[model samples]
Target chain A: MGELYRLRRKIEQIIKDGNLDEHQTKGKITLECGLLLALINENTPDEVNALRKLKTAAEKLLGNF
Target chain B: MKMNSLKLKLISLVMACMLANALIIAWLLLDSFQREKNTLAWQALQGAQETYVHLEENCTRTLSATLAALLADEKIAALYQQRDRDKLYRYTAPLFEILKNDFQVTHWYFLEPETAAPAIAQKCFLRVHNAALYGDVVNRVTYKNAVQTKTFSSGKELGKTAFALRVVHPYYHQGTLIGYMELGQEIDEFLSTMQKMTGDAFALIIDKRYLDQTEWKNVRNRKNLPQNWDDMKDAVLINDVLPNKEITRFEGEIEKIPAAGQILEEKQLGKSLYMKGILPVYDAAQRKVGGILILHDITKINSNMKRTLLYSAVSIFVLTLVLGGLIVFVLNRLVFKRLDQMNQTAIRVVGGDYNTKIVPTADDELGQFETLFEQFRNVFVNAVSGIENAESKTIKTKRPVKKRKPRRKP
Candidate 1:
């Protein structure tokens, strides 16, 4: 429960900051980042796997630009 | 000029290529025309020089033949040896009329070898003007040289626009040189004939020393000349200089070729083009005696070339514009339109509409991409529907039901 709460706080902070990368700290939350946050809120192993896949997709999207 | 749409970008690319091609073609066309003009200029100069030589040759041939006829006349030789002036006039009266009126012989003077006085002198024009008609001629030295060698010689007459051929022969009275009889023929008649033959103006430029004589200046004062004739000391314009009536282009950039013995140049004025060539004349002693300037009008050819270039440029510009428009239309309809539709479908699928169908129109790479995207959408739709069904069944199973055994205990 404590780890879940800490992960929720981190996700909220990431969403509020609208950025996940260390150097990138500005801009609105992307659809990919929003999808990742929604998967993390599910709190299930399958959803966590989906979150990991979405994180990879977000990284790929950033790399494309 | 902006790369905003695919249609715009494609049209711009094609138009740019077309414009570049048109410019290159125009440049090549202009270069070819320039080369052609250069070649024509050279040929024109050559033709003018040939015409001048032809005139000179015609004069020489006619004078040579006339001199031969005169030498063959036994009565003239007898009259010269006797120095009979009145009898000589009676003997040569009809022959002189025939020579002057029929043959354009301007001057005829028979010089006696021992004296400076002419044994018999006759002229076509009764003006009694120049010394060539008399014995005090500026080319008397040339005449004496011809007599000494007993050969035919041709030279330009001073104080006149005439080129004279002097043929001095020894009249014999039983194997003795009695006196020298000389014949002189001027060039006005030959020049008029040449002008009639060729449609070009001719000018005979003499040395300044010839025109510097008092008699020559007095004669020139009667003729029409430019106001600055005296200042134009480079080449003395003769009295019979052909007027530049048709020449609209008279730019004073006559190129002087010292080695070629001719000055050749072309000029463009308004819509017309004119070519001028000056062939230098040399005497038998290889001295630069004078020049013959010929003007040829080549305006028709120049205008034809200009019209061709203008037509080609206009045609090319219109063709390029039409071709560029056609290219843009084809690309927009066949390729870009399809691409735009596919993009919209992809955006809808990205917004979670997993049932978005992509209809491919061709077998190219784009078509293959569209097919793969449709398959991905199908799989995503099936997976999402299956997940929803499974979750509903799990929720039904987790719902607690009231136990029936608790009612029996009550």
Candidate 2:
């Protein structure tokens, strides 16, 4: 529902499609975004920096930036 | 630079190797220089010893020739045979003075030959230098040898406070043995002459065992020299041709010097550096009685060596820096920069820029790797494009009723 949750779901889908490890892919994105994906729920506020960080992390991990 | 990057590791390895090589070269150079300096000091010691021997030989030869000429004078032989002390002294004192002044001859002697009475045999008939001292039994090896062999004998002899090169010839009158004529020179003159010849300092250290301390003290006092009889443990400094008397203070056994000589360590005396050595001094009986300490000034040579080492170190540092810079530059050009280019291109391709290619700068191994990577990128891009096209076509086919509606609309 939230923009952060949408970005997280898109990353999860890319990882599943690529048959990549879920925890490792999330960990890499978390490291890149400097935020924990497990804590980012649908009700979480979509801050501008958080959204930009999530988009950049997803683009870096999945190569669609 | 990244800590674990290949470029950093390669650069670190190169620097370490260069440092190690420079250290090894410096050590080798220093060792070689030290060995060469030591060899030069050893040669100087040997040369000084040889010069001493040569001077002794020349002094002995001159004394022998002079003694022979004096023995040829029938009057001198006749005066010794007559036991005329006053006339002999008057005749030879001026000659002794000339010999002392011109030839550095210090002692002159006339001795009674071996007779049936042992009390009178080898008695000092006359000492040309000292008319007050006479009738003392001459018990020296050279005198005994000349009396026994009845021929010319010459050798180095140690006296109460001095060493001298003595030459003895059996005096004969009308083919009958009369007495002995001897000419002598003090060996201290050799040290001074050798110093002049080689510009090196020298000291004669006689063993205390061969010397009486009272007589040594008395001689030192008589000569107005320092009464240093108790200065050394087993040896006394008899004479030295040194600018500083302190340089003659050695703390080693004179008799322990090797026959060929012993090279001592370099020492810094005042502002100058010196290389010291010792040549064993043997009396006529071939007994090691003393040692000749030789000191050669090596300050200039030592400074030169240090300067050379400093230059070498600076040169190595500069060369290492230059070489390191060149190697780093070449490696960055040939490998690091190109690898970085390949990494950026790979990252761009992963980010959907498939048209971006890896262009190799050289036809080396990295270039070959770049070509293979480009081929793999081409294959991957074509496969992805084909999959995308297939998926679109499948989506169009799967429209079914929508496709029929689309055909009705058309």
Candidate 3:
């Protein structure tokens, strides 16, 4: 058991070192796309377009109403 | 979201991605099925409209012909005899004989122009009548727009209310006006035909508030049944969407109420609906006054999907178990096995077991470990050998010096 403990610790240390290298290349820390994607999901589709149209129509109608 | 170690975090992330992908795929499939159900429900409604339109047109044509024939017939003309109080019972008997019996309208009465009192030839009294002047009724009708069923009472137990659309045909003779004929048929069987066509699907003849006026019959799980869907699914019949009326989709979660009419009305929630299909209930002139809402309950579909996911999860668990076994096995063979070998070698070297050497196999990180262990072994063996050699040389040199000192002393 004592011998097993020693070996396990050594192996664990090696794995930690390898993980640090992996994170440097493929970390969530590097990408700036998550927030944008989240934004797109919360709003209704075509609703913005409809509002934009309403705004433009209001402008036109005011010029003529 | 918090993970234990880097390895654990990585594995958990991969597993999370797999679960998310599975969930997304399941959601997409559910959405597609929902769309298909909506389409099917719409087609069924269209089919019902076509059938009724055909039947109504047929009945109208046949009744118009019968009315014409009655006007020309010798027997009816003789009965047009009573001039002082012309009770239209004679006109109605022939109308019933010709229109009601054959054409499927149970109530056929000549609505008088001055008085809307149903002149029943059979009883000479109104059968189902709120008898008033036809002109007054028409004026009220014109004001109200299209004809419809009005709820005389409230709640669920009052059976159903009565309202009728008028079919006005003026009866003229020589140079005088006789009266206007008002034709109305209780559309029970016509609606029944619609119910029949919509097998296993929910069909409703909704009234002014979009509440169901027809008998609630729903099809559930492809089962052939007279499903009493008084309160089946959590749905909302979107009505009052007039061409000019401003209304929203009542964005929110549908309340947990079993009936379809109840709404949660909270803007933050999404309505979990199985289907939403609406078709306008047309007037006799084929005008859109109100519509029928045919909704297919997809709650069972959702539950079945959940069950399918559960099944998929179990299968995925099994697959992952196998994959986990493979990973463990491969790790044991390539990584842990090498590690165990290196561990034993390390134990030997640490235990002062000199001359212990590990033949390096794959040139990996473990190979570097083996190289390190080999160097330690060489240093240990050389240090032990040099100590033994030094001790022997000191003993030999001391013995020769002792012999020379003894000889000189003698």
Best by DockQ: 2
Q: Give one digit per residue, the lDDT tens place, for model 3 in B1-410.
A: 24664445555566676667666766776677556555555555566557656755665565456556655555544444343233545344555655566666554433333322355321222222332322232332311221122111111111123223334344345534344443455544544555565542333333333234343222222345433333223323322221121122322222211222321111211344334444444444333333344444445555676677677667766666666666656655666667667656654443334455777667888888878867776886677566656755665665545344455554
User: Residue B94 of model 1: what lDDT?
Assistant: 72
User: Model 2 off-target regions past 4 Å?
Assistant: A1-65, B392-410
TM-score of chain B of 3: 0.53
- TM-score of each predicted structure versus truth: 0.69, 0.85, 0.48
Q: What lDDT does each candidate get?
A: 0.58, 0.84, 0.42
lDDT of 2: 0.84
Mark the 10 consecutive residues where model 1 chain B has the least summed lDDT. B120-129
DockQ of candidate 1 relative to the true structure: 0.06
Report the C-alpha displacement of residue B200, candidate 2, in angstroms. 1.1
Name every residue pair that clashes in candidate 1.
none
Residue B103 miss distance in model 3 (angstroms): 2.2
Candidate 3 lDDT by residue in tens digits, A1-65: 23323322333344365563322211121121111111121122435444344334323422321
lDDT measured at residue B121 in model 3 versus the true structure, 0 to 100: 20
**Residue lDDT tens for model 1, B1-410:** 35697677767788889999999999998999877776766665577667666877776677777876877778777776676655666677677778778876656656545433353222111111122243333345555566667666665454344355444454455566555545556655544565676766666666554445455555556665443345454555553335453332222322343425443577555665667666566655555666666666678877788899999999999999888888888787778877877766655544444555888888887788778877876886677566656766765776688776655554
Q: For residues B259-376, could you state the per-residue lDDT of candidate 2 as single tens digits? A: 8898887878888999888899998888999888889999998899999999999999999999999999999999988888876665545434567788766799999999998898
